[model samples]
Target: MKVGVVTFPGSLDDVDAQRAVRLGGHEAVALWHGDHNLQGVDAVVLPGGFSYGDYLRCGAISRFSPVMTEVVEAAGRGMPVLGICNGFQILCESHLLPGALVRNQRQKFLCLDQRLRIERTDTPWTAAYAEGQEVVIALKNGEGSFVADTETLDRLEGEGQVVARYLGENPNGSLRDIAGVSNERGNVVGLMPHPEHSVEELCGTGTDGLGFFALATLAAEVFA
Candidate 1:
């Protein structure tokens, strides 16, 4: 399967994401933020970065990128889309996912190896993980706290839309310790951690993050 990784002007992790895709046994297709084509990739990944210099709020400007136009359409048609860190913010800004990522409770930028518990495995991005499985991945962000209305929060919990949660201490004060979430159809996922950074054991970050990308092949088959 070919996974497309979009690169915005301020994108910092697109190259790492492409490498992770290859290590996960898939071809990585580079897509430009200014392009409207998806290049017929099986899935898409919105890598983390301070797009548009994080002006007007994180992900607020990047959501209007030309590539996102295609991404939003593809996601609607059941194509799998994974958003990481700032990418998660873009997903919310684009209305592809519910809730908002606000500044952390401490109001400071955080960077650490975060422990997260897999809450659901039905989504394409998480199918390789077991429910309740715990994994440590790189997490870095100043605005990573997830917030939603009480009713929406209840609905997400009841429907199992919450994909992952912080295991130990809540690093960014995300509500309910939520670390990741998925759309209603489970094809779109937005995670606050950087799975791409933890794919190689040589990096001493462990291989837990690889599972997030390893399952990309199954997405085309299962979601089709």
Candidate 2:
């Protein structure tokens, strides 16, 4: 599988995301945000980081990058698009996924290995996980709170669009403890946690995050 990882002006985790893709037995394609090309990648991963130095509300500015035009189109065509952390924010900002990411309730940047429950494994990025499975992944961000209106929240829950939820405690006060969500098509997913950071067991967070990449490969194989 060829997974494209987008790099923006201030992206901080592109390297790690690329490494994770390679570690998952796939080629990692480096994509520039300014480029209007996808390089024919099978799947795409929007890695976490402070794009545009988080100058205009995390991923607000980066959502308008030229590459996003192609991304939005591809994703709409049912191609898998996994957005992590800041990428999640961009997905929301782009309206590919619903809701907005606001500042953490504590008003501080947090970095830790977070426990998450796999609420829905039907998406492109979570097929390897069993429903209700608990996995730990590293999460780091200042503006990571996920917010939406009551009706939207109800719809997400009612439709089973909520992909993952925080276990034990909510980290950023995300509404309903939502750690991840997927679009109605299931091809586009946005998650607040950094699964790429936990792909290596040596990193101490364990390799549970590898399930996400492995799941992507499985989904591609199943569909192709």
Candidate 3:
């Protein structure tokens, strides 16, 4: 399996994400935000950080990155794409996922190892977990609150698009405590937590997040 991790300016987690992919037994390809090619990777990961220094808005500038055009097109064709943190914001900005991530309701950056419940394991990025499984991963960001119109929220819940929900407490006041979501096709997913950071147990967060990368590789195998 070959996984591409995009690095945008200020992207702090791209290297970590690539390491996670490599640890998951996949080839980790470094991708540039300015590149138009995906380098024939099997899947893509949008790592976290304050891209473009979070100017204008989190992920606003990154949504227009040259790579995003390919990402959007590939995702439309069922290529699995996982967007983490600021990447999640980009997914929403690109309309790859529903809802917008706003400033934390508390108006502060949050950093913690948060517990999350797997709500939709059928997506390509989450198939390694059973529904209702509990896993803890690192979460950190300044703008991580998820918001959408009432109808959109209801639709997401109704359509089973809610991929993961905060387990202990809502850290950012995300609606329904949503920590992650998948597109209707289930190929594209965006999550607020930093799964790439938790894939190494020596780092102390456990290997729970390893499943995310593993599952994407597995899905590629299954569909190949």
- Using lDDT as the yardstick, the better of models 1 and 3 is 1
What residue pairs clash in candidate 1, if any at all?
A: none
Per-residue CA lDDT of model 2 for 1-224, tens digit only, reads 78899999888889998998888788899999999999999888998888998887888899899999999999988889999998999999999999999999999999988999999888868888999999999888888899999999999999899999999878899999999999997889999998898998778499988888875544456568
Which residue runs of candidate 3 sit more than 4 Å off their true CA positions? 216-224
lDDT ranking, high to low:
1, 3, 2
Q: Write the per-residue lDDT of candidate 3 for residues 184-211, one digit (tens) a residue.
A: 9888999999999999868948988998
Per-residue lDDT value at 75 in model 2: 94
Model 1, 32-150: lDDT tens per residue? Answer: 99998999898999999998999999999999999999999999999899999999999999999999999999999999988899998998889989899999999999999999999
Better of 2 and 3 by lDDT: 3
Regions more than 4 Å wrong, model 1: 216-224
TM-scores for every candidate against the unseen true structure: 0.97, 0.96, 0.97
Q: After best superposition, candidate 3 residue 62: deviation in angstroms?
A: 0.8
Candidate with top lDDT is: 1
